[model samples]
Target: MSPPDTDLLHSLSAELSERLKDLLDQALLGMIRPNSASQFAQHAPELENFREAITHSDAKDDMDFLRNFREFVPTTNYEPYRPYIAKFFATPCKESDVKNMFAPGLPYCLAVSSMTSGKSAKTFPTYRPAPHLLHHPLYLSFPHSEGSTLSPSSLGLWQVLTVECEDGQSSKVLPVCAVTVGFQRMQMNWEVEHDKDRIDLWVPGKTDPFAISLVKSYRAFFILNALFALSDRRVATIRFLFASVFVNFLQYVEEEWPLLVDCIEKGIIPDMENVDHVRESLEKHFTANPLRAAELREIGPPGIQGWAVRVWPDLKMFIGITGGSSAASVPKVTHVLGPSVTMQAPCYGSSECFIGLPYYNGDPNTDFKVLPVDGVIEFLDVHSDEPFERVLSAWELVGGGHYEPVLTTRSGLWRYRIGDVVTVKGFAPDDGLPVINYLHRRNGGLEMAFGVTACTESQLTNAIVSASKRSIGQIIDFTIVGDERDTPITYGYLVEIGGEVGEDAKMAIEQTFEDLMANNEFRVAFWQGRARKPTIRLVKKGTFTEYRRQKCDKTNISMGQVKVPIILSDSTSKEWFLQRVIMEL
Candidate 1:
């Protein structure tokens, strides 16, 4: 029997794409208009006060408010550190010992030790005694994947806290120490009970008005339909909630350092009710600052970067994954946070093995120094014909080389390929450990005509980067999809332009891509043989946002975990992107 024609498959795909697009549009419209004004009336009082505070407060008033507000929020204490220290050091120290150890001040100890040793805690030769020992442990945790046995719950409430405590005496603690609360719950089922548990972990039990308000805002999301409304008020409320929670927590930590320690030591979990009382108190405070209403109106769209700046203006460092989709989002995030906040990637690891830590230098793209204590690290040259034979030790890695990480962990993962591909950034100065940066996933690329020619995620990213530089406006986020059903397989590029880019600029971008592919040997060869000329589709604003939201909804992945991959390898993701192409340029 003869096989079905390729044209038939392509036609069917086109029909399916159109149908999906229509459904998605209707769903998005429904999501935006979820609640009526009457439904939001209960939150009006709180919202009004929030608006007043933002509009009327002067620079001095704002600073004072932040100062006073931070006094009430609960922060991380020695309790969470006790378990972390015990796990990392394999020690059986008591809670009192942990407190005393950090008594002379945690930040001072870490600073002095790191400066003297010329190495981070992750690379310290051995655990030193007393004050010096504070700089020798990099608190690592697996928050993403479910394959690992370690649960965030095992460490208790503070395990889920994102706040970092600083001792007033020395003014030294890790500039950035945070628990992964948001993404940690990405693996959980999205039921009400699970959602409640996640919220409790995120905000913790705190009776302070701000804390209670923050917790209530999170609770509001439990009524998903009500919170998902597209109204400006809803968006503003969501932003305000995050801003209030974070800013309040920051101020609370800064002001009530001793009280925080007391709570931790006494194991006192606050009663997290009194939303009405909290609202009343906040309203009273804001009523004095009438100008804050205008300021509130001026607050930009809902995003973390802006909220972060307002809450913690003294932010010195930000630690997170800077590779893959995270890398793409860096431009948008940093732009929001401004230039002061230094970005740092803490380590390169997955559910399988806690790999290593990056250097503390100011460079955002600094490579991770492999942790020898964690497990055995190996690299296989993925481009090599015999990848197995090309296995190299951690010390044997060459600078600027690409290799897949193979970890042999103490947790029974023997020579397991974690599927992450990394580039050797360089070797550490003090230690010979190769400083590597994660590049992409091993199976994360597009293969045209059964590997006749394959376009890597890195390559596609490079093209987008090159195009953005040549284009009039910045390209915020982008995704590439391989359409195999077509007779000549084509790659569709869905590019989201950040600002206004006229038709002329868009054409210029297309021309730039054409010129780039023409100059490139591999892409040129691929197009000539199997694939057709790649098409660039400029999607409407919020296309990627909707894409991410929909994906999170379908997969139960949290917004934190919903990153736009440069290359969509999965059929579902590719189809979804293809359907959302608002315009072909």
Candidate 2:
């Protein structure tokens, strides 16, 4: 007999509550840990004030909470390093001087100047550089494509970091030294020009193969540049390398590791114009660096942990997303970067909203702390049948509940459903504000027989993670495809193994799946009277790379911007994966 509706809801609520309580306990433990607390105290020396600011009675509104949080925390706007940036600009330098300032073999030099008048004046200040002299500031660029989700806010943040200074400090010199990515060209329409200035760093046009190659080379270039900068001791200390997630960074490293190792062994920098030369040089380098040669040949683990430990030992922190696929890759990243590096989540944000909230360090359960100043955030109870009518404010959310984020942003996105489902881990100690973690995309799920059984991306991820841990061979990436054409619908998984997988590893993966389906009632129900077993396809190496390339070709998205879509929602994407399927279980 089917379970009663009320009973099902109660059971789900209880389960959610229990899970949340467990997460809250873990978060509390992390926060109050003797060593962690002591270290935070030592760094800030205002622990009590920070805690009190959040809990203060008058701190009832979002703006009030944001003001208190910003005052307590060291933000991107933190002024301690402002003077260092200012000092660099104060010294007069030419274009050549600016170019030569960067260490030899670095790919790009810093480009800095005060904002120009008119159009530039609106977004930036009107301070000019000395005549015939160029200033070197930290500038990084990315490929900008129309309709892409890359946030303009991130670029704006870079500008703020470089230009904004502490109150009452009257230095015309913008203290932070960094340039926002992308540039504007005259040929583009006025709207495009304004958008490019606000959003992009690189000038948009026909795709330059060389520029594409350079963009692909950025990860290696960044590491090499950091090492060179560290050697000179002129630039500020390399404290944190920030990105959306370490996984994306790891993928770039994995692709370029062999080439980079070749350069190091040959003691020569790679020439962008000559791919053949680079390959030949790498071949010669491998003869001498046999140890690295062997490591590279063995697809043991994801990431360049060994090289990072050896080269960037002083690198202290990695700030990025710790949710979704990024979280799955954390163990591998941790194993590679080692304990010296502190992995931190800077904040939660998206293309629509630039900054959301601060992430609680060491709390895997809590995704991010909401920024009261950013926008109005509402939650629709995900468990309720009519979730839209059951809207809850940030303060109104209870611990252990799941909800869909509905954001009304300052940037003109009104009541926009960000399509993210969040789980409330718990409330902050002082003001009782909810701490949430991104669970999965709202639409990230597969339905069988019109919702007779459904599996979400989160569930699939969990199962894959469990399977990987149980298997002897390391699986790098995977995607799920549902076949509804069959009488009993069958789900197929295309998995990429890090190295060659034998029968034992394959059996282990299959067995793990069997165990998971057996344990999950929803999965079991979905499969009941249909195919009892789902098929597993072990894809050959380089399959995902090819998939990404193809995706970029079809979508007009830059190769740099293409992400591995975990869910194949459409027939085209699904067929693409199906064609690449190598084996079936």
Candidate 3:
């Protein structure tokens, strides 16, 4: 039956089962060597220190390193994921011994992000990679079938935590900020006021060290006002929730991560040991006592994931806007449209620059595909323009041959760095259109299978929201994020109801949304029997705005920002939720 194109799980499994055979076939073909004269050509793009790597993977044999992933890439790796790198129980990216921490083969050390910790977020990768980092090309695409499984050692968002006790010594947690959304871009100059008091969305660029630091740190914080585009490419539904546009990294690790949103909303924090002691601890805390309010935060994002598009309705508005963050375990419905769903894993990127990978499908755990040949990638010195590692003139091999990615794209970059590591296998005849695919940085984030796993928060949002018949202004604000590790589900929260929703109304709305998301039988079963519909919480007037105002400590204006859900991994998060969602109300 067309190889079960609609069923992501089955497609991935079936394809991976044959991965062994696929690889063998490719290896045999690789036995043939390419002509030497045609092998070492150069199209040096006025760069440096990366001439050799550019052609390192050139088809040594006729196919060992083919121009296509589908041809050479076995559905499965011959060997199990055996990382010979370092293993950090508590310290994922950081360790007492950085050298002994990261393993090879797969990956033991995850690439970290600078997530929003109460204090400093980044601590690991103590060593700074010189700017332009180069990785594979397939790191950008999110095909249709992936989402089978994840490795036990898979690292979520990288985080580094530290507390200054006015002492000489120190302790730390390497918490990373999700590559997509966080306090960074959300920091706006627009502030609303309540009479004499000013509500702060983006702290005034005038004072506040935090605000000043954020403003000074990243010169450009691009805010995209993305709406869901339905089947007909119509804006079916509309809401506003976009903290980041890079939901790529958060897409890995699970399939139906959306279900977590229902569980959290229903106050179901069942013990999940996805990460050994860490997940076990989270389970205990989440299921412990009063499930009332939960303290749920992210190591980073998936923690505070981002958007599918760019554009804000009234970006530079008159007042304070609500905050947007996927900081909740329940995940947030940043914005949902009729059949508008997207997933993106933001890892596979370099701190020095932003190179990334998208999901294989709208769900997490999907195999990833590289970006289009129209894109280019390049590695650079962390602080300078010197080319460091490799270079990808991938545009050259588009449909011509597959190779590692290294270039500078039009996506605001110079000696642009692509964040991923890969060895080209072969090309994929994607619907008669071929594209290159490759592996990514291991030990740092989620693992992968065959058949193209993928995710794009923006795309997902677009699918749902686009399908919605609601007007653009109906959904004031919202955010959507991956919730767990076991399944590829999603969770969302709509701050404004647009109208009242009683039992029947809620059911109708929920069912409508389910129809949009769970179109197939597998998804329908999960929602009807297992997957609970998204929880629609109607915040009392300015409850969220008030909460933000109190936290801001600077103003009391209302800015309608769609934040990611509260991620409750421990008692701390649960308790915080209790105080916020249960107690205050």
Error of 2 at 77 (Å): 33
CA lDDT of 462 in candidate 3?
Answer: 40
Q: Give me the candidate number with maximum TM-score.
A: 2
Top candidate by lDDT: 2
* Residue-level error in angstroms, candidate 1, position 451: 3.6
TM-score attained by model 2: 0.55
Model 2 C-alpha lDDT per residue in residues 428-532, reported as the tens digit of each score: 553344667778877776665534435566776777666666663556667777766565665567777664564565665566466557546555565566444
**How accurate locally is residue 316 in candidate 3, as Cα lDDT from 0 to 100?**
17
Tens-place lDDT per residue, model 1, 342-412, is: 55565666533457776543243445767644345667787788633455555455677789887543322
State each model's CA lDDT, in order: 0.41, 0.43, 0.26
Name the lDDT of candidate 3: 0.26
Tell me the TM-score of model 1. 0.52
For residues 30-85, what per-residue lDDT tens digits would candidate 3 score against the true structure? 22111111111121132222233335656444443333322222111101111211
